[model samples]
Target chain A: MYSRDEFFLLIEDLSLLPAISPSCRSAFDKMEDPEASLIGIGHLIEEDPGLASRLIKVANSPFYPYSGKVGSVREALVRLGLETTRGVILTTSLFDRIRGEAGVYALWQHSLAVSMISRNIAGHLRMPYPDEVALAGLLHDIGKIPYFMHDASEMHRSISDVDPGRPDYKREKEAFGMDHMEIGEHLTISWRFPSIVCAPIRWHHNPAKSPEADRTVVRIVALGDLIASAYGLGHPEFPFVDGDILQLTEELNLLGAEVTSLLTDFLYDRDLIVQRSHDVF
Target chain B: MARMMKVELATTEDGEMIVQDVHDMLGRLLVRAPRRIDPELKRMLLARGIQEVFIPDQSSGDAEYERQIVEQERDAIRKRFSRLQDTPDNKRIVEIFIRAFEVFHAEKGKIPPV
Candidate 1:
């Protein structure tokens, strides 16, 4: 097993780790702005012309409800509001900016699927801040990005052998001394996201033992991950324990049927997002 | 001698102003108001089954402080980039932030604190 410090250090060493470009730093600081966060993010998207194009594409897609086709960032912001737009833009930017071409396509689809599922489940359960839950889902597997960046072919090998009923990801976590969720959490915190979000990304895998785990949000991502991982849709090759989910659902006051329905939508959206992954910078 | 802190409540609909100096009587934190006394709001709260509603802005009829963050941002950005002769993306990132700040300023009609 890799030592804990070593596993965490691998995350710290990511190439993009130190470059807190002024824009990103400012975004983190502006997170406290209660009134115009969406507008601010819309402004950010407009700056990255390519991201603006993709966001418009997704907003206009049939998956979301629109009075008509969304033709501009302002229209999209008006439709999604500040919280939801910020969530969507941040997720899209990370996928666009942080990964390499080789293995990123699949994970992008997976993260979106997880996000859709997590949001749907949160709404069904009457959980607070469904959009925030979706943001957590988008970020939950973020650790895998750096890991894939560090070594692509190795992750591909592991993907070929994943199974959840047995919990083999435990071994890999011990081997590397950390798992994807931990790595993702570190980056999210470094980016200055709220603790509500950073917690779920860290604990979605091992909710019971995770230091900052939020039962509802973590459960949403964990269950969504299971479906994605199982179907090989943005699928990672990692196994999760089944009973852990049952315990979490009970703790979070959610039902299996809600999760299953969300998973169906997630899988559907995953197809479209994956096909269009090339639209961003 | 304990200093009395006067607490008052006002809303668009109805209001209560308690003027007595509540020196030792005032609670350190907000306590739940008695349910039976607030029959109307209590009934609404029960139907929603959500106990708490978060109100973002808390204002008293106290002295209002004008917000002052946006005024210096453009200047800050210009000055920050002036020293970045060594790096380019650093310049780009700063530019992005300033643009974002502009959006915030435009929307809120004021700039945020630097």
Candidate 2:
């Protein structure tokens, strides 16, 4: 089994980890700066034509109300907002680095579903930093990426062999001496992601254990992940533990009937969600 | 099967029969209707850029058909939540999933409206 030190060593050694392009890294830095303007970020994105076009396409995606009107990278960045653009860039950049590796594509699909669900749930709840919540959902499963990178076949077996009663992370713990959530927390923090975005990745499986400041959004992401799995949008091999719906709803300041209504809406729009994922990926 | 339903081609299961002929933009016949879509056939269709298809709605019919679909959907939901103990809270949560699925099917005209 891999030790926690090895995991940290892998993350700390920048040369050993997947490389985020310098331009992407620079853009990320500018995004985090309070004084940076949209034009500055747009110019940085334009350094990579492919990335710029992708941003434009995402701006026109069905997720935004301004579809077909975003004509440039600047406009896309402006329309997507700073928080969401950070998410889009981070998600796209990280996934792109390992695009063809085994299980990566399916993982990306599941992430997209969770991201969309989280965004919609946040919108419905009028939560602060809906974009950050969406970012959290998109990167929640990132802990698994390193394992797949190490040994694709072994990772597949580890995930498949999980007992029904235990979460996938517990199985990972047995195999690696550390769970995906722990790995994800370290990786995201090492990459300089904000605490709000890293909180869900660290505690999505057990939101109650998250810090009090981030517990609400963490719970939102956890619910989104569960709902996505229930909708058959998750990896086919993974099973989920039951979420305490009563506790979650009460904590979120929502009634059970309200959640039902929200779910009904999601069900009605599931096809659209699938199409959106297909388009983005 | 009583009525034809528009379904996402990716979600179509093996052995489900297509209800219409699929043609390319060039008007060339790609696949004929009344054909069962196996894994290979689904791949070929998807490779040709077909994302949606008309299929005989197996879930549309009398009370028995609705009951069967509900059972299947519930079974799927239950399996997703199989890890949880049989507690009142878990039961309510599973019920929510089942109810939302039924509502989706009903709204899509695959069954009687709720």
Candidate 3:
């Protein structure tokens, strides 16, 4: 029923897997604890020289303006907190692999918009793990990559805001036999991502009424999407969630001020997202 | 736990819960199907630890969605996943998904196979 060529874009190249990122490697080596951090994460990253270089690149980025030019991976770690450093490495590595249309840069902007809005929403609500919410929000639609199936960047813009729940993803499944969410979830699992990220991915698109009404994490991602839609930065294929927001607000017993506050942060961070897409990506 | 009827993937609602449960149970194994669960959407869900080939259920549709659209897309997704089963990576991937549901939710309630 649909004519689509899937590129498995989101599916991580199992072979190209770099162990981890540089800062993660250095910090993991210094770590006494395993669960909170790991040595393998850093060592794996150190394996990729490219990751090492990117850490320096990220540290130099205006996000972390170091007074003195402290040059070294360990110094880079100190300047960018260990976790943020790790995020930088991972983000860079992931970005290095993505190839798409000229508009992909714009798509990156949308992702960052969602990511920024998600963090703002989480913070306004005093939700824990703000960074995670931001990361997930930014990469939420990462699945769409392979949906374009390594084709021209034009393919992405070409996709109308068709009901992704309808024909676009359905057709994508027809072409590749798996949707981007499935691909992304598998990639994360394969990469050994924590469940906090994985669970939302599964439920992000379709939140469970009963469990969502109760669980904080579910509410977080679901809410993140809502805030992102409200921000007016577009992930077109994403559900145009307006009317549902009011109903969801009532159902979640949320106040209107809570929503307004988040939108404010979103606008605040809009520059970071725009800059990151152009500079970082 | 007794795994429930291998969670059905007929509807988007079914798809969400089924995918969530499978993902929760899978641990390191990735079991997410990005395709939103809805009647007639082409989807493969491992729910309640059972991997079921879903053809959207018309009986479940109310005012918004019905069988006409659901069935066509399903056939498309079916073909998609079937092709994956033939690949080396996906072959192992699917097995890992099934094993995860089996081991994790064996006591919850098993969902029968398709």
Error of 3 at B4 (Å): 62
In model 1, the Cα lDDT at residue A179 comes to 70
For model 1, residues B1-114, the per-residue Cα lDDT tens digits are 222232111111122222231211112222242112143442322222122222222333222212322333344334323423435644543454455455544444443433
Q: Give candidate 1 misplaced runs (Cα > 4 Å).
A: A1-10, A13-44, A62-67, A81-90, A97-102, A153-168, A171-175, A210-213, A230-236, A239-245, A252-281, B1-114
lDDT for position A147 in model 1: 53
lDDT of 2 by residue, A1-281 (tens): 56767755665564223466777777888887889988898999899888888888888987554546888999898788877786777677767766655345557767877777787788888986777787888889888777766656566666555355666677778767778898888888876778888899999888899999998888888888888777756654453545665677778887777788777776755666655665666
User: Interface root mean square deviation for model 2, in Å?
Assistant: 7.8
Q: Kindly report the docking quality category of candidate 2.
A: acceptable
State the DockQ, from 0 to 1, for candidate 2. 0.27
Please, what are the lDDT tens digits per residue for candidate 1 over residues A85-139?
5555566655555454333555666677677767777877888787778778877
- Supply DockQ values for each candidate: 0.01, 0.27, 0.01
Model 3 Cα RMSD, 1 decimal: 19.7
Model 1 deviation from native, Cα RMSD in Å:
24.4
TM-score of 1: 0.56
lDDT of 3 at B33: 38
Name the candidate that leads on lDDT: 2
Which is the winner by DockQ between candidate 1 and candidate 2? 2
Better of 1 and 3 by DockQ: 3
